[model samples]
Target: MNENLFRPQFDALKLSDKLWLMQTLATRYHLTFKELYAFSRWGQSCTTGLFEKGGREFVFVPGNTVILGWEGFVQGMDKANQEELADIFAEIEYEGSVEGFLRQGMTPVRQVTIGPMFVGRKLEEIGWESVPMNDPRITAHPDWLDALRKLADRDGQSLKIHETVRFERNGDSWKAWLCHPMTYPEFQRSLLWDLAASLPTPDEWAYLCGGGCRTLFPWGDGMDYSMHLHHFESPEDEDKPFDMEEPNFFGVSIAYDPYMREVVKAEQFTTCGGDGGRGICGGLGIFLGFLPCSPHCKPKVQEDKELNGDYDFYRPIIRLENHD
Candidate 1:
């Protein structure tokens, strides 16, 4: 049987399509508030104001956009509902604790509450000022936060946004959201492939062989660096852990790998082998030997004009292709 058949026909649809499909589904099946809430993982709204779904839960900050609140779960149905769906006008009631749900390992079947403080400081916390807004690193976090903040600040009151969630004593909720921020404009997401496609391939390759020599920087048009790597080195063992000294390798004690049969001597950088070839081959974990720069492509500006305002978190990098 075609799995898509039992599944909602519009399961693959975007958020916009899901909205219309949900309304149509509700009207067609005549689902009720309680049933819809059960299907959706929404515990309640406005009164006890619990929006519990799956194993997690939330408290709705009333007056926020209705679509943002409920639009995430319309397509994925866990099971078929036999109860007649209720109309919005019909009064329904439920009681659950959003706080309680989150305390457990269970997550709300879907995402709703935006992590407020973490999002507010995403750009400043990271080094956005060092890069351009159009830069991949620059746009990702701010764009995502903007979307979330816009959702929270719909009515534009801090208290109103906070009021949107009140987790019950044993309800599921968002686990620690210290995760990094996200950028948008590529529609769904900017996979690494997208970043690679934007970068123009280098016309030439320069090889490095000297023990303390760095290779020619390789980068082309479009965003050249999608990410960065950090290395730490120490030379002496201290009570704390280790310290950097004359023979200090980058981020580690200079260990001689017998298999490679090479003595990884201390280099100019705090890393082990500083020879040109060793520095250029930088992949994390094997060794924190060198820092390599790659292009990170930024997507075209979004169609939404409202998103064109200045972003405090990112500086936009514009690289003009040389016509010559």
Candidate 2:
């Protein structure tokens, strides 16, 4: 019985066309009838802010973008929308608690605020620093020390430096090691789950890097070797730290680096990015070394293997509300 006759012609229609079609549908059928039909097609999930289609659950991310699939949320976000979301993130107060780590100096914990279609990067990698015995950030609480000791023991390592503090810092920072891909997920479950924050997925990282760009680097298709900083230059040359480099379209810093960022996919495989050192200017040089820093690049790493090096670091994502 040719059901095609009953189906609405929605394909090939623009957004305006779709709206016009809806208006026509509503007029031909009673408004109530059209409403019922629309609800039957998209209501359940739409009302719940979740859409299940194509075997994937489309979750509503805060701001104008919706996470349609794992590929990249920015694909659904136009430049204006992305900028608007970034503005929202820029205005959001840091409601989360700050954990101060005492090293040579007190390093207050800081996190970059990013929401759907927005982006962020850590000022520096997480590292351990030595602090004075009397540093105010030092906590001698027996329970805290016990917990630290237990964590070290579980890692089969002995705890050193009674006054040691962990922190995220720039300049001479140490790498996070002996941690598997699940490490960040477990940490989120233990600490940040309540805050509605978690480690970023691979897709999130890629989006943060490229936004909608398919370029060799996030900023553009070309990389001027003159802009290369910190790695290849002489000591007398100005030190242009990657973090201080101009931000990408989404205000994310340090899109490419000799160091690798540890990331996870579906909480299963360990992957790394930004490790490829340097390459020629364009996509043609991707195979040389630029591929590691390419937005879509996902260097494979064994899930079970603990990435024990200074190169591996993780970033966190804070989930924002769709409404205030």
Give the candidate number with the greatest TM-score: 2
Show where candidate 1 strays beyond 4 Å.
Answer: 1-183, 186-214, 217-229, 235-291, 294-315, 318-324
lDDT against the true structure, each candidate: 0.20, 0.38
Task: Estimate, for each residue in 1-324, the C-alpha lDDT of model 2 and write its tens digit.
Answer: 111111122223344544554454334322221121121110111111222222222222222222211222222433543353345335554332211110111112222223442113342333433454334454544654565556654553333332233422223332221212235445446335433335556556654554434333444333345455434455655555543244443334544554455554455546555552433332223222444665555445554543433455555454433431
Clashing pairs in 2: 175-310
- Model 2 spans with C-alpha error above 4 angstroms: 1-120, 123-185, 190-195, 243-245, 276-287, 307-309, 322-324
Cand. 1 Cα-lDDT: 0.20
lDDT of 1 by residue, 1-324 (tens): 222111233234454543443344334333221211111111221121122222222221111111111112222212211021121113233233322321232112222211100000001111112232244542455644464446454543321112111111112211112223233323112322331111111100000011011111111111111222223323331223321111111111121120111111111101111222343243222121221121000112233322111221111111122221
